[model samples]
Target: MTAFRLEQALGHTFRDRDLLQLALTHRSFTSPHNERLEFLGDAILNAVIAHCLFERFPRLPEGDLSRLRANLVRQDSLHQLALALSLGDFLRLGEGEQKSGGQQRPSILADALEALFGALWLDAGFDVAGRVIVRVYAGVLDRLTSGQGIKDAKTRLQEYLQGARLALPQYSLAGTEGEAHAQQFRVACVIESLHLRTEGRGGSRRAAEQMAAERALESLESAHDFSRQPRS
Candidate 1:
């Protein structure tokens, strides 16, 4: 989408367009990147979440509120939001970064989401950006309140093993298939010193690992007779 369209979607036109430009500029593209903006955005996001949580869950204690905020502002959550906005296409990256798929990197996308909010705050004000954040985070808020955003499958498995004093789960690629450009990876998850194992497939090693871990978690949960926890 065009910058104009993005601005329109954001419901604010930047008087200093450079702020918006800087928000789109990755570290690969410039000496002084959007790191500062990301920092500011982080604080702003926390404050906004805190305020919302305070009002939404007046009876909720500090710890629960903190957990809910953590769930709402996680890297994966921000990356999903960035994808919804198609923010990846607007990122200004160096040639190498562009070619190396920086646009699809969760870390990059998550930081960019924060930077965009920072830019909006700078261009308009906290009120404007806070509104945007609230709108974007509505689903997260709902999930948190309903206890559906706590302890995702991955975390549940980790905790289950940790409580048993077992070693952390290990992942290995079992095989690959298809053409060079269209390759798919098969990954296995194994618990040390046990025959328990499971495998899964995906388009990339990381994706394969995730799928494998998920499968492992499901298998363990079923074997251990543990109730499925909410995903965060």
Candidate 2:
């Protein structure tokens, strides 16, 4: 798709044409790449999504809201949005990236989508970019609300890490407390790449693991940068 058509699809015309081009240009393409834009957009996207979830689901607790936001903003979700925009066709890639099919790569496409959001915010403001994000995610949000119960935290965490091609988190039995038959368990969830460790206490081993996973997921969503790939 041409840049003009992309603008039409995105529902925002850029005042700065160069910003739009920068957003679409991958690092491998040249200097002054989209990584910084991606970082800014990542923050804006998280804040916008958090606000949306908070307002849309008033009765939902913090953990559930975090889970929903994580699902919506994950690389796979952004990749789908990119594909819907026919975004790959418009990407400016280096020869190596182009030959390696970088346009279709989930990481690049997702980062580009975020960079586009960054561009939109710069061209206009949060109001415009937030609306476009909500619209782009409308179908996904609908499906999530249509009696799709919250996914298991452990499963959700695994999917999140896997989506970014990060190393799987390790869950270990830390210890136990209380007497026999009434003991509370402590589980530690560690993701080495992010240098993250979270602990959860529960009445059973599975419960403890799930709690740990939930905390870990929340930390990953709110604190860590999922855009970074682990070293080979």
Candidate 3:
């Protein structure tokens, strides 16, 4: 996707096109890249997301609100949003980076998305940028109303084990498959105290780990139910 196309999708036209171009440029591409913009964008994203969560969950505690914000602005979530916008296609990467598949890297994609927000802020103003952010995250924020977003599988599993004074769960990559851009990673989640092990596969290692943790949580929950059952 071209920059113009991305601008249309973002619903904001850049007054200064160079800012947008710079936002999409990786450090590997040129000296004047997106890092500064990314820094600014990261702050804006956090603040905007925090405000949205605050208004959405007025009754939620601070800790729960913080967790939801973290989940929403995390690298994985931003990378997913970048993919939705086809942002990688607009990135300007050096030859080496291009050959090494930097475009598909989560860190790079997330950083670029933040930089885009930063550029929008500079080109127009905070209100305009905030509007764009809200538009981009509307569906995600809407689904988070129940406070269910506070606890992901990994967080739930960790808390479950910690509450019992057991060792925290450990995750390791079991294996990987497929091409560079579309690799599937298999991850194993282990709980030494419970002698529990679960494996899951996904397009990214973090995703695979989450899936494994979810499976482990389910197994642990089932075990708890069995233990409480009357003698059989």
Candidate 4:
């Protein structure tokens, strides 16, 4: 099943089979897993996505383009790409990682997808890699046009508060969940004047804060009154 999916995703069969094998290897499984490949692929992926956004949105400034690229290339986005390729099923995981569910981990899956791109680049060169990237990234790139605004969480939250003349929003960690390595953070966004509190959870502190801000935004937007409603 994985073999077929890989063939379809890559759109090329490897003459040097070890390259394909290396791409699928996880660090938890092998000493020389795909980290190096992931590093190289990360650079290429950034460049490719940057180029795409630049060409597609000529009027969009650098900051906006950067934001779009960030949204597109973030961990969640890459994990979705891995899912599309059925990449998790093909991962060569160590016994411990396998038992602990490495396949479903966002970082592992995202990194593995980048490593696979790096592997494709090595096996077939730039042209092949370009095709693979464009193919896999087309949908995500399309979504960027209709995706959330270019504003970051902090900026958006600030704008919402300033506009309403409400006290500024402050963020604090409510708590942490999961283990040290895979910790999940819960963040609280507080409006001091209104005593409004909104919480969000994510894999990291910043992400948790952003989620909280987004929730606050949604809640505020849904209600007509900015003070009584959720902060947008």
Candidate 5:
């Protein structure tokens, strides 16, 4: 995939294409890889998420804000964002890593995303980078706000399923769109026992899963037939 396409997805064209190239360069790929950029990106991501949380939840205590930030910046979260960007297609992975499917791995994608953030900061400075970050996180932040509670819909749905002695819901990345900045993530939420399937779309996979879970829960609650209790 060309950097131009990824740049379009990011909604931020790099002034120095080298920085973007370096960000996508994996350690396994070559010398002067993105590890340093990854390190810097990690800091930038944390700070950006933290600031957003602080501003969004002024009444909430520091601990709560920290937890929210942690949730938003976790490896899985970053990986979802990377998936939204189809970033793996643009990664410069070594032959071995490529053969091993490292492109789709969570750690690699997350680290690459961080490296991209670092590259953005270097290329456009923190202010511009921060704007891009916020744009990418908008759906996630909006979901968090809608819930108001720390426990998301997926958590609540899982607990409900467990309490009912039913199998856990299955979530899969169904597909994604080539949208700008915050790409659309489509996910399928399925419960085999009930023969139920729900789809959701959001800016990130996590958000999409949560939305799917919420829909599943709603469907289950509204239609009492789904409440068939499992044998003890």
Candidate 6:
């Protein structure tokens, strides 16, 4: 995957090829890397995403808009976009980092994707960069549900119980697995008032807790008579 291919996928041609090259160059590869561009791109990405969300959901409150923007610009979301563009194939990494599978790492891919956007902004302008970002994220934006922007799973679960004057959901580490660098965390989310528990696993404890909370919320929503029970 050359810069030309990336440009085609990104739907923007770079006036300055060096910018694109620098965007793909990881710090492990050389001194002139993508970190600075990543910084610039992070700000641009947030602004572009915020503007898009503001336009798309005119009736949404600021909190909802912020949550939606956060979800859209999260590392996982950016990594998915990077994978769709095959951005990793064009990354310039050092020999050790390349051998260690740095290309597939979500952090690296997300940062490089941001750097590419930064380069695009520099090569063209904010208008072009904004258009490209909206284009790349169109599918994601379209698939978003009305309930998505309200709150994240953990926050929603906590708020739901707190509204009823119930004890907040308790999260505990269930276990862990895999190697040091690639370990998986298992977290349990407990709702003792309802005598219900749900578990989730992810690459990080925070992620696992979020997954568990999502599952717990689903379980609560699906129960036929659970909400009718007395609050503790």
The numbered model that scores best in TM-score is 5
Tens-digit lDDT string for candidate 4 (46-164): 88888888888888888788888887788866865776677879999998777555665668889998988888888888778878898997755553553354455567678777877
lDDT of 3 by residue, 22-129 (tens): 999999999999999999999999999999888877899998888888999998778767866878899999987776556666778899999999999999999999
State each model's C-alpha RMSD to the native.
8.6, 16.2, 8.7, 7.7, 9.3, 8.0
Error of 6 at 35 (Å): 0.3
Stretches of candidate 5 off by over 4 Å are 146-232
Global local distance difference test of model 4: 0.76
Query: In lDDT terms, which candidate is top?
Result: 3
Name the 10 consecutive residues with the lowest summed lDDT in model 6: 223-232
After superposing candidate 2 on the true structure, give the runs of residues whose Cα lies further than 4 Å from its correct spot.
146-232
Clashes of each: 0, 0, 0, 3, 0, 0
- Quantify all predictions' global Cα lDDT against the true fold: 0.76, 0.81, 0.83, 0.76, 0.82, 0.82
Q: lDDT per residue, candidate 6, 55-114, as tens digits?
A: 888888898888888888998678667866878899999987776666656688899999
Instruction: List the candidate numbers ranked by TM-score, top first.
Output: 5, 3, 6, 1, 4, 2
- TM-score to true structure, per model: 0.65, 0.63, 0.68, 0.64, 0.70, 0.67
TM-score of 2: 0.63
Better of 1 and 6 by TM-score: 6
Worst lDDT run of 10 residues, candidate 5, spans 223-232
Report the backbone clash tally of model 1.
0
The per-residue C-alpha lDDT of model 6 at residue 172 equals: 99
Question: Which regions in candidate 4 have their CA more than 4 angstroms from the true location?
Answer: 146-232
For residue 10, model 1's alpha carbon misses the true position, in angstroms, by 2.5
